[model samples]
Target: MPDLLTDRLLLRPWRESDLEPWAAMNADPEVRAQLGELLTREQSDAVVAGMRADFDARGFGWWALQVRATGEFVGRAGLDVVGADLPYTGVDVGWRLRRSAWGNGYATEAALACLAFAFDELALEEVVASTTVRNVRSQAVMRRIGMTRDPADDFEDPSVPEGPLRACVLYRKQAR
Candidate 1:
């Protein structure tokens, strides 16, 4: 897919240079708080590689997000096909920003761009997002992008080991 530009953010494909900071972000305890355990360097690079492959195969996946003016890699934001074992199946919007990038409105900005691409470019009818019930920050981003949630849609993520992160809440936005 082509690069998506917001007023302050650029959503583009992963880069080779992103490995170091990406690994650093993944290793941060605060950044990993809602996602999962900290990942090893190999594990982090593998994620970027997988994102590149997924975009090549399907034309859309997580984009390596950057600040347009400073050209700093802030984090990642994009869509992924929800795993089939989940209670529901659909494209899910996601973002992972560096700790320094938090509370800067970057996630909301990038997410709105991705949501527009999902609806306006790809013609998808809906997109979803889910996180652990404790991940209120991500849920706030979801709401900021106009996604809504139904209490009944919340379910346990079987893949996540029993922990605070296992109980997930689902949110969705429909094409307008």
Candidate 2:
């Protein structure tokens, strides 16, 4: 995928040097809380490898989110086809930023760009995003990006731990 530029972010592929900070973010409890599990450095490397391979093979996946002005790695935002049993399948929009990058509209900005990529570049008909019932912040971002809830499409995420089926809220926006 081509490197995407926003006002403050540079969306590009992952680099070998990004592992340390990425692992740190993955190890952070608060960050991991939303993601369901904390990853060790080895696990983080495996993830980076998977992401790199996905991009090479599919031409698109999660791109590393970096600060354009400072050249700092903040987090990642991009398109993904989450392989979980649910009502819908195919490309989905998602993002995850460092705690310091939160509340700065970076998520919304980067995500809107990704949506544009999906609808325009990828020629997708629609994109979907879902979060745990308790993840209000993500849900709010979904609404901010003009995605609407589809209650009938909601279901338990099989990839998540087997406990209480956390109500997964599915939100989607159609391509124009």
Candidate 3:
């Protein structure tokens, strides 16, 4: 897959050096606050492996986010197929930035790039983003990217145990 460039960020393929920071980010309590439990080093590396495989197979997957000026690894952003058996199914735009990377609008920037690639390059009809009902930060990014939400589209995430995180709200943006 080609690297996506924004005004200040470079969304490119994963690298071996990224594993260390990636694992550290996954272990941060605040960073994983809405993402469930922390991941071990092995689990984190496995996640990177899965993302790489997805990119090789589909030519589109989460890209390792980096700051262009300083070449700092920030996080990841891309499109992923919403799993089967979920209340809904389709491609979804997602972004996860390190705790230090927050408050800079990086998530919104990366998500907008993913949305453009989905609608313009991939020609996907629609893309959805779902998050825990309490995750207003991500929901804000969804809105900033022009996704609209319908209360009727909300559902309880079957994978998550019954709790606040189980209730998820979905937002969608159709190709224009």
Candidate 4:
């Protein structure tokens, strides 16, 4: 997939150099609060590898987010196919930003771009997003992107172990 350029962010494929910062971001407790347990170095490396493979094979996946002017890797935002066991089965938009990048509106900006890519470039009928019921920050991003939430669509994420992160809320937007 072609790299997406927003006024302040660049969404592109993962790079070898991103591993260190990516691992650091994954290990941050504050950042991992909503996502899951902190990831070890090997686990973080594996995720980067998987993202690269997915992007190569599918032409779209979690693209790395960077500040265009400073060329700093802020985080990642893009779409993924939800696992079949989940209540929702479709492409889902998601994002992860470094703790330092939080409250900067970067997630909302990049997410809106990915939503357009899903509907316009891929021609997907709809895209969904989910966050732990307690992840208000992510829920805010979903709302900022114009996704609607229905409590009835929410579910306990089957993949997440029974914990604070298991119960999730689903939000979705259909192609306009």
Off by over 4 Å in 4: none
| Model 2 lDDT tens row, 90-166 | 78899998898989999998999899888878899989998887788999999999999978888888777775435
Model 2: CA > 4 A from native: none
lDDT of each: 0.94, 0.88, 0.95, 0.93
Off by over 4 Å in 3: none
Clashing pairs in 1: none
Could you say which candidate leads in lDDT? 3
Better of 2 and 3 by TM-score: 3
Clashes of 4: 0
Query: Candidate 1 residues 1-176, lDDT tens each?
Result: 79999999999878788899999999999999988899999999999989999999988999999999999999999989999899999999999999999999999999999999999988999999999999999999999999999999999999899989999999999999
Question: Could you tally the backbone clashes for each prediction?
Answer: 0, 0, 0, 0
| RMSD, candidate 4, Å | 0.8
Reference-based TM-score of each model: 0.98, 0.95, 0.98, 0.98
Question: Among all windows of ten consecutive residues in candidate 3, which has the lowest summed lDDT?
Answer: 158-167
